[model samples]
Target: MAQDRALLRVEREEVLGYLLLDSATVKGDSVRYEGRNANSHNDVDAIRGIVRSQVLAQRMERDGIDPKRVAAFARFPLEMHTQRIDDKGRDRGVQLGLIFLGYAVALLLYMMIVIYGQAIMRSVLEEKTTRVAEVVVSSVNTDILLAGKILGVGLVAITQVLSWVVLSIAAMKYGAQYIFGEQVQAAAVATAAGSPGAGGSPGLGLLAVGLPPVPLWATVALFLCFVLGFIFYASLFAAVGAMVNSQEDVQQAATPVMLLLVSSVIFMGPIMANPGSAMARTMSMLPTSAPIIMPLRITLVPVPWIEVVGALAGVAAACAASIWLSGRIYRVGLLMYGKKPSLGELARWIKYAR
Candidate 1:
């Protein structure tokens, strides 16, 4: 048994299924083996080649032919690529670069909302706890102060996002040069320009050479979506912060907003897999989710101008409402420092502001 293991070069644990082993056996010129199921195409093909060798040897020996008299060669190599289904019943190729580009953009918006909104919330909490609000509000209108804070922090967030965009572009353009050099660049461009038969797309060929997948317009839309989404959510965060006196209270106050942000991220998987699906299209129009889903749809599939315009209008309206309501709550809440106010109390504060 030990000798068999030595010959197989497979550990005892592998036989027990604790680990996987690629193995074969030879007996009386007959070969038997289980092919290794590896992730790589070449490895799988090689295993299939090994399986075919036994039949080839049997035919040769039956004919009383020497192995030296027979040879096998491939006329040409087989290449594999994926294609996209187009509008006119034609299959193009999926552009992985654009898919991931959209994913990155959507993810960035999610992070900015969750992270910077928390920052805004924390800033508001600090100013109130420290009594800094008294001195600051003495001169400045509370609404203006709230707007200024949201805008200032939002500008910082936008700057960081833009930096990431520039860095990503630089990495794709220059990193390819650094890694593959001029020779690889020429080959990739050539492959992208060529057709991969009638059934497959050449997009993957370009992706293999590190070419950018998304168009310029998608990037622009990604930025625009993030900007509008940030303002809409940040205003809510400021209100949540104002309603609470401490960080612990902020969590309880901000639960609904947090869930909304998280739901946007959760919806990303389905949207990316089927951007043209009815559900994805519907979510892309919702103001709460549009910031994340719309960009994903725009990046992965073709979206109509009407849906885009309607979504923008919806977000603008939501933003306006959040700012107006949050500003009133923030003004009243900043001065009330005892026990956290109830929802009814918050409503009264908004009414008082009006």
Candidate 2:
């Protein structure tokens, strides 16, 4: 009777073992066969089934895919793939083109305005100290002499500005793509599409647009403003040089003018941050500060026609006043030398100089 019960228990366990083995095989067909003995076979099959199911569950968890929950799977990584450009010869050619064109233009403009303007002032001062102006005045009218000096210096500055502009255009045409990169090009295109008649930004977009596509009217306005501003400052610088007997005196006299220029640039940060503010509007209309402020306002934000006209008129008036003042100072001081003139003396010179 005992032997019959043991045999029955063994038979029931065999049936359960076979079912577990079949399930394990379905999940993974790499299950190991322990032996043909009934007890050994049953233990191996049960262990294999449990192990396989646990591994599958862990894998699902790691991938954020729960067995009991439904979710969509990502088909690819979350980064954009782009092909690299490997045209070494083309890249080299573009780089050289940019160096020759872009750098040349920027350097020329700087040298013309800053370097030559200083040269004019120094020349005037040297001639005045040496009393050469008295001899020149005997042969030529004072106004004629002034006109010749202004014209000669102005021509040099103009030539430099033109050369730079030409070179900059050439650089943009040849090497802009390589310099600015693909992302910048895309942004420029997007910006242009959004803002019609605007030359998006300075870097890549400026290069891509070249010369023809730029806003001609705006460019012309800026150029005119720059010319007027330079003339006004240069005349003042020449007058200051004449008033002083030495370079040290010239430096002291020119401090206020330099400060004015520096202050205008410093204010640009705040103006740009809040373009529509009353402060910005007022500063933009001031002749002394308008050259820098007006251009920034027009380029960065929506500027009203009235403000533009007001700024232009104010700057033009200031330039005219500066020319008159400079001419008066030059007429009197260009013959005086030795000691630097005081403020009171300068006022008298302007009041009484023929």
Candidate 3:
């Protein structure tokens, strides 16, 4: 029994020695091994390589452990530390600009889609009811006619958004003195204390506020995303308008789509409030919800580069899918003139193109 106990202890010690060389599970003493057999050799080789590269001789002479090894284990790599600083700076800037731009762009998009979408619906109904659509259809292909109308109206909507953005920026710049009087005064006071005559100097406070600034790049990216998102939704709206013969019918069809947009927007608010939340992460990846969610995410969260790339890719794919679906509906709904189609008929439209 004593001999058996001694043999088991020896075996355990040998096992421990082998495992101590394993990079994955080399931490202190361990009871259970938890690594794959496949990469064990490679991991061991890597650990050996790291140990070899470490200047242990210099470490013994200088600080007992090589400064490089100490840094490697105790502190982040210099490149990584620099990158972290850069990232923090970027995140701070993004946080400031994102809040301002997200709200502004969201409000503008909501207004434009609602207003111009209604116009498209009304125009479609009027054209069809007055038999004007029939005349136009005779002269031009339905597809071309529909594309032209959507493009023309979309261009107008784009113009309105641009105008609003410009006017809003101008108003904020000129009206800051009136709107934020106390804050500006406090800033000026702080500035004067630091540099006595700096107060009376022209553009001193303005310089303090930061010039050639205002997150223009972030705003541009947000606007481009908004435009793409709008195109995706508006195309569906146009199709729905084509399907319905009258204003009342269009309203019924438009309700679902509008509700979806509203729900996406509402969902965006929560995501903005906690951009790092799991729900926000999931929603941002979804193409249908991404347009609304991504901007909000940019505002509240530090979205990883990979996530941004993946989300944009998903949005592009979804846009392609939406376009395909919209084309089918547009093609079928353009020729139909009577009662509105049922859900079943819509299903048939999917197969119409197929």
Candidate 4:
């Protein structure tokens, strides 16, 4: 009976924010109602605007006045899209593809780090809890063990990602027209209004608007970013697993790392709106967020070679630092038991451990 109150955590579930009220019309031209959705104010406001327009047109028609002229004057929506030019003075849908390509790649990197990082933590914790590490260490060096766990998992992850990338490339190259259909074709034409006569190419519509030439350099940079950034975060996760005494303590230990990861995604909209801003550049340069942010900048515009090298270098430095620190904690913590160590103890491990 004491076990009946156990709590079970579930994954692949999340709550979405929503606000809705039953609207009522008390009287003509005097109806009042209020509702808001914190997650999507634009959609809610668009609904309100559509309703208001309908009401205004109906009331004006009843008063022997045509609202068409006023509606035309109001100009329901001013349709427009951005104009993106590459360093090569090219805009044949490359920049448009770059927009989504950058966003998708960054998001994938974020998810990979979080997901695989937790997997490493869980693996470390399981071994430590079951006394497997004690026996394993008798035959193997701790540094080698740590490196093996990281590289093994990282290799599998990179392989899976490469498979997905190949499939996506094939899909975009061949089956894109059927997948996107007529709406995307119309949208491609609409977006072409900014550049004029660009969408007139026969049989290329959405493909021309969606995918771009992914250069070899960008591909190499992306691979390096994924490997280095993953190792950097994965080491920290392995340390957290070693530091904690139980599953209950794991959340608290990993919270700071999770927050660091999540913060990088929050500024994406603002960064895309102004890719060349100082905030974007700073994030791109910082080792903590460079994996995701730097890829975003690379895809958004023509970033300088120096900035790219600096960002990659920063990630490499971070990877080395985290690996070193985690190794120190891991070697001692795996053998120590009974309770979690304090911050001072972790510092001492780094400073004094052989």
Candidate 5:
């Protein structure tokens, strides 16, 4: 009965017996066993099973019988070990930070494109509405006038963007410590070290959480994409402005372009989930969607250098083509303004402008 008892305390590779007999003497009924396991908790069952088998063999030997014949021989003993569940390469904080950065870049680009694009539209409309375009047309070529408007507004957008970036970086470096407090900062560091489930919630007040470092190359790529994207869409906005006679007609003219822009943003989630998917890759290559999708993909996956260069080339070509086509519409539409022209008349204007 004593040898059959399985539960025993393990100390320094020795098994201590829990049962005491009426004879006031201790017997070595429990068996000692060694196991190859990293975690002591996982070795508990293995140790107990192995020790029980050994104790039975010892009892058989003590009873003047062959222990090997009487004892159970396992062809394959069951072993259990805990495998590491977390991927060391997958840093959640860094991943989240990269995603947030990409989202911020995409958002800022969208806002700037829409804001400055509309500004160009309104500027063109104001000049045409006041008959200033007529006087200005004498001195400026229509292509050059349109190009100048895009360039001027584009420069202002660039300035505002740079100022915001500088301020944001400065705030992250200098102001975060003062705002978040030392305790929250410590908690942030502790959480990032992989004990997130062990304790209290860090909450949204952890301002000192470390963000993944933004690669310099990504910044350069983002800037180039923003410029090219702005020019491409701004050309269309200018064309829309020329087509419409008044602000009331602007919404109707601008809806298609705005919808296209909005759709690119809407596809952001799918792009992030499967950056290597065909749909994401195709969208990243397109000039209209590339600006938003490519940046988001960059933060999450490795985009080939050739793809980046190819997308840029595609966007540049599209921008040039847009400027040419829009310039034609803008030239003819700016002067004739009693009512908005139909699609047939706009097509005629394009041929005549050529």
Candidate 6:
């Protein structure tokens, strides 16, 4: 404490805070180091790696253990290569950005799907409750009404998504200039131009070396995915809204459909981290998750053409199925009122409704 105080005075530095290790023990390869979370986690982590290792080594030598033998207990430096995943030479900053980007895109897509899906449902419920559907169904087809509602709501979402894409790109460009300076930006641009498919990083040219923008192709793909994905979910929302007699029942009926949407987000962290693993590939293909999951791979890396095609096909088919089932329910449920229908009845509606 005296030496630290003297050093602080000599260096003309102010004491901010201090850390005191609570406990440490070493006995025959059994090592324990206790720390408080109030200290930064990095500090605690570093203690385990550096400080504890040093203490263990010194104690081992004091106990007459060979220095090399004590050193042998240090954590081994290991390299692992995962199948089909390439992270070589990618800057940590770029990797972090990709992770964040995937998460952001996924969060945005999920919100839009849920928000607008419920919006479509609410609109349907309003129509049904107001007896507007009874009047409209007299002329306009329910399937047509459902499609039109989805299209209208989906178009608004697309406009917002496109605007965000454009602004984000512009902001990222300016951010690179502000952060990395013009020379680095120019160099990145040059690298990106020279390398075909570098957009997989969706970054500035060799932007991984700097900072990257999402590629134009990925933006296009994102728009298309959201469109079809919205249709897939929105149809179900419309169906749920049509089935329930009152607003109280709306949420209860919607819960199961909402669960499917929620389930997609559960795998996001793992999918974004692996992106090429079987889990990622499978999630990206399933209609329930593909809307958000496929975009992650589309933006981060170049997925195989076959996988991309298959993923889109699966989502498209799911959309068709959802529309078909929802349309049938909408046809029957729009008129039937009073009590909430059971799962069995809903199935019968699907089976028998023209």
**Per-prediction backbone clash count:** 2, 1, 0, 0, 0, 6
Which ranges in model 4 have alpha carbons more than 4 Å from their true place?
Answer: 1-82, 178-210
Q: What is the TM-score of each candidate against the true structure?
A: 0.70, 0.61, 0.64, 0.73, 0.71, 0.67
After superposition, the stretches of candidate 6 with alpha carbons farther than 4 Å from their true spots are: 1-93, 175-217
Q: Write the per-residue lDDT of candidate 1 for residues 1-354, one digit (tens) a residue.
A: 644443243222232111212222222222222211111234335544654555456556766676455663212232223223222221133355556667877898899888999899999999999999989999999989998998999999989988987886777667756765655455565555533232233433443445345546656666668888999999999999888988788899999999888998888886676676688888998999999899878766556678888888888888889889999999999888988999899989999984
User: Candidate 4: lDDT of 137?
Assistant: 97
lDDT of 5 at 318: 93
User: Would you list the C-alpha lDDT of every candidate in the order shown?
Assistant: 0.69, 0.59, 0.59, 0.72, 0.70, 0.69
Report the lDDT tens digits of candidate 2 across residue range 185-247: 674564345321234443454455443222455566566666766777777778887888887
Where does candidate 5 stray beyond 4 Å? 1-93, 195-206
Supply the TM-score for candidate 1.
0.70
Instruction: Give Cα distance to truth, residue 225, candidate 2, Å.
Output: 0.7
Write down the worst ten-residue block by lDDT for model 4: 4-13
Q: Tell me the lDDT of candidate 2.
A: 0.59
The alpha-carbon lDDT assigned to residue 165 of candidate 4 equals 86
Name the runs in model 1 displaced over 4 angstroms: 1-94, 180-220
Task: Indicate the TM-score of model 5.
Answer: 0.71
Best by TM-score: 4
Question: Per-residue lDDT for 1-354 in model 4, tens only?
Answer: 311111111011121112121223211222221211111224334545655566556556665575556654334432112333334333355344666688889999998999998999999999999999999999999999999999999998898888988898787666766865664566577546543224544234436465666778888898899999999999999999998878998889999999889889997776776666789899999998999898888777667789999999999999988999999998888888877788898898788867
lDDT of 6 by residue, 1-354 (tens): 854453344233233223333232343322322111111223335544665566567667677787566666554331111111122222222333555576778888999999889999999999989999999989998778878898999989888877987787676656666765765556555444433223343344433353335657567677778888999999999999999988899999899888888888888776665565688788889998899899877755556668877888899999999999899999999999889999899899888998
lDDT of 5 by residue, 1-354 (tens): 543332222222234222222211113233232221211232445555654465555556666575465634322233221111111222233334555677788889989999999999988888889999999998989989999999999999999999998898777666877776675566566556543222234332234554556568777888889999999999999999888889999989899999989999898776665566789889999988888788877765556779888888889999989998999999998898888889999899989994
In candidate 6, which residue pairs clash?
192-205, 199-202, 202-213, 203-212, 203-213, 204-212
